[model samples]
Target chain A: AQSVTQPDIHITVSEGASLELRCNYSYGATPYLFWYVQSPGQGLQLLLKYFSGDTLVQGIKGFEAEFKRSQSSFNLRKPSVHWSDAAEYFCAVGGGGFGNEKLTFGTGTRLTIIP
Target chain B: EAGVAQSPRYKIIEKRQSVAFWCNPISGHATLYWYQQILGQGPKLLIQFQNNGVVDDSQLPKDRFSAERLKGVDSTLKIQPAKLEDSAVYLCASSRAGGQADTQYFGPGTRLTVL
Candidate 1:
């Protein structure tokens, strides 16, 4: 079984400040990790994903995540965040094919942007 | 490309009532997923489908929950005798099938509130 853990339950950051959300995963083989964001009433949007090569991966809306195999972590980072960035963020892991893959998601971290 | 689509954006019902959610995946996507997101928790996978066939439903409470994908393109999830604990956002997601690079795209989700 695969699982994801997000240490922070809630995070608050001032507008224009840098942001980082921690994520750790437990999987036997090489894992595929992803970051997703959800607005108040909208579905989740993919922030980024890491499958193979290049530990650092970039995503939409000025977000990036680095996959650290040694640490078993894939943390999301942004140089600056906008008020719109305030939302619930989730970390997920899967270890199979597209049609056959099963995902295990973290409990999620609620992000608040202080204006 | 159009994103995943879900119906009845919101639903309010009393305990023991029944409710159903519908989802339309992307045009060529061969995999579909159903998830539940509580108020402060991350989305949990309830079921996964591969072209009209179920791949996983281990986490689903079969006693009250049922889902089906008739043609592999669209899916429906039903909850019979809903409970207050069933109040959450039901989300539908889709991805291209075959290999490990299945990046899921989520729908806006249907918010179900049990009174």
Candidate 2:
């Protein structure tokens, strides 16, 4: 079964500071990875996705994630975090088949930005 | 274009009561999904539909939970005899099924509380 793991439960960073959120996955084959963000009382928004080609994939909101197959990791990063970036972040894996289109998500990482 | 639409942003009911949530996917989306998210956890796939057909429902509890996407446009999720542990956020998502890459758009979730 495909699964994802997020080590950080919560993280705090000052405005304009660099940020990184860790994610790891377990799957037999190459996994399709994704990162999503959710604000309070809102639906999750896609941040980035990794399919095959590039190891590093850029996303909206100045965010990016690197898919490291060796370590089974797909960590999200931002050069600087804005106050508006405070939200919950999730990592997910897909790519089994049509019946397996459902993503396997990791426990989310709650991000808090400090002024 | 409007994103996925979900009704009843919040719901509170006593244990053993029945409740239903609705979702309208983005126009032309062939695939729809329902997920359950517990507090501080990632969303779990409850069911998946592709053009009104059940693509996958392995995780859904058939005894008390049921869902359908009639005519391949809108969908509904129902839970009978809800348990206290079922108090969580129910999320809906949509995507273009049969694509090489599975990209899903999410809807604002329905927060459920069982007292």
Task: Provide backbone clash counts, one per model.
Answer: 0, 0
- Share of real interface contacts recovered by each model? 0.80, 0.67
What ranges in model 2 sit over 4 Å off? B98-100
User: Candidate 1 on B3-102: residue-level lDDT in tens?
Assistant: 8999989999999999999999999999899999888788888999888889889899999999999977889999999999999999999988835686
After the best TM-score superposition of candidate 2, give how far the Cα of residue B20 lies from its true spot, in angstroms.
Answer: 0.6
Q: Write the residue-wise lDDT of candidate 2 on A1-115 in tens digits.
A: 8899999999999999999999999999988899999999999999999989999999999999999999999999999999999999999998767556769999999999999
- The DockQ-derived docking category for candidate 2 is medium
- A24 in model 1: Cα distance from truth in Å? 1.2
Q: Per-residue lDDT of A1-115 in model 1, one digit per residue for the tens?
A: 8899999999999999999999999999999999999888899998999999999999999999999999999999999999999999999998865456777889999999999
Model 2 agreement with the true structure over B16-86: per-residue lDDT tens digits: 99999999999999999999999988999999898999988999999999999889999999999899999
Model 1 preserves the real interface contacts to a fraction of: 0.80
Least well predicted 10-residue stretch by lDDT in candidate 2 chain B = B95-104
Superposed on all Cα atoms, the candidates' RMSDs to the truth, in angstroms, are 1.4, 0.9
